[model samples]
Target: MLNVSNVSRVFGKKAAVDRISFTVDKPGFVGIIGRSGAGKSTFLRMMNRLTDATSGQIFVDGTDILALKGAAKRAWQGQCAMIFQQFNLVPRMDVASNVMHGVLNRRSTLATMFNLWSEADITRALSILDRLGIAEQAPKRAEALSGGQQQRVAIARALMQDPKIILADEPIASLDPMNAQIVMDALHRIHTEDGRMVIANLHTLDTARRYCDRVIGMRDGRIVFDGTPDLLTTSAARDIYGADASFSEAATSTSIDTLPRDQNYATTLLGA
Candidate 1:
């Protein structure tokens, strides 16, 4: 369970994340939506402890996260896996090696520096890549994969951590619409198959509605709406985007339904 109380992050005169509070007492898929600079990214960073909060507290399973130090803080970070907009893979390294690097935080620095991975770790990494439909690319350099395939590699690396929660900062924002669908489908499958909490920052309303069970809308560092996806109507989205009632929903939609009907397109595109 995750509980955030009055958490805020201020940058000079601006509060990137205001005194925002929310709770996730159950495993589910959550999507955070708003226009750019809505503090969606900052909130996720605070929860991951990448950014310290200016005030208030965050508790995960009843443990005060802000009070943890050193190894305890590192442990907390490990439990909360983060996926960034950029794939963040070592471009020159083979996919398997990059995936094994996920466990480097828990291993000896010297061992990792030499790339001395255990046979079991290698097997596990390959298993994760296979689960994401990229095991064949494990022997190839990270740079050789397509953008979407690279993102899958990134997800495999995150899964290598066996995190209790996954925080994705705009996981599909950089991909083509078809690839975006593929990546979102992978994330949705992970949530359903592992029963883990998945929180993602999404730029489009249709993507959120299609996959997330719950949606949280933030505007100017404050949550303007929080409820089921069905409740995220055009009017609610307008308020979240700070648009007048004349706002067109098309402006915030990615039009995912118009993508190619071929579900295997991602695989074919991978071979391009």
Candidate 2:
């Protein structure tokens, strides 16, 4: 279980994520929805310590996640995988190679530097791709696949890590509705088939209604609503997103400055 107690992430004087508390004890599909700049991504990033929080307590099971250090911190990240809006694959690399990168943390220091993918790791990567229905593209360049296919490749990479929790930050935001549905299907299948908790930041209410077992609404960095999909009334959505807001309109920021642009960041983001 992931327990968040009075969590807030402040950037200077602005609280990107205000004081919020929630507990996710069940392993299932959860959708987080809100308008643009509602702090959804910030809260998700804070879960993996990708971004720091000004003050808060975060625990997985009984361990204080915020207190971890060194290898322990890396272990915490491995337990929680994250997917991004953009399919962050190495465009120039083969799909199989990109997927194999998921197990970088599991490799030895020398092995990682040499990019030594063991035979078992290669087989596992292929198996994951086959499960996701993309085995045929294994030898192709990641950039050659369609958007939907690329996202599935990303999911396969995440699966390779064997994470306990999967956090998808606006994963389908950049895809068309048809492609988005495919990505969402892959996400749903991952949760149901593996029993890993999936927390996805979603923009569309209809998608949330169709897939999420639970809906958590964020507004101004606070959790305004948390309930089953059926219980998320139209009025509640209005309160969460404000009146006259469309599904595509979300308060998001383009801030990669805080995230390190390195191999470490790439691997950490995958398993967190």
Best by TM-score: 1
Q: What TM-score would each prediction reach against the true structure?
A: 0.95, 0.88
- Could you give candidate 1's per-residue lDDT for residues 1-272 as a string of tens digits? 88989989999999998999999899999999999999999999988889988998999999989878899999989899999999999999999999988888999988977889999999999999887888999999999999989999999999999999999999998998777877888898899999999999999888888899999999999999999999988899888998863463677778565664336744744542
Alpha carbon lDDT of each predicted model: 0.89, 0.82
Candidate 2 lDDT, 1-272, residue by residue in tens: 88899999998888889999988887979899998899999998888878878898898898878778889988878888878889899999999999998878778899878778889999999999877778889999999988878888899888889999999999988876555656676788778888889999988776777789999999999999999989866677777887744432333222222332233422332332
Clashing pairs in 1: none
Evaluated with lDDT, which candidate comes out highest?
1
Residue 3, model 2: Cα distance from true site in angstroms: 1.1
Which runs of model 1 end up more than 4 angstroms from their true locations? 245-248, 259-272
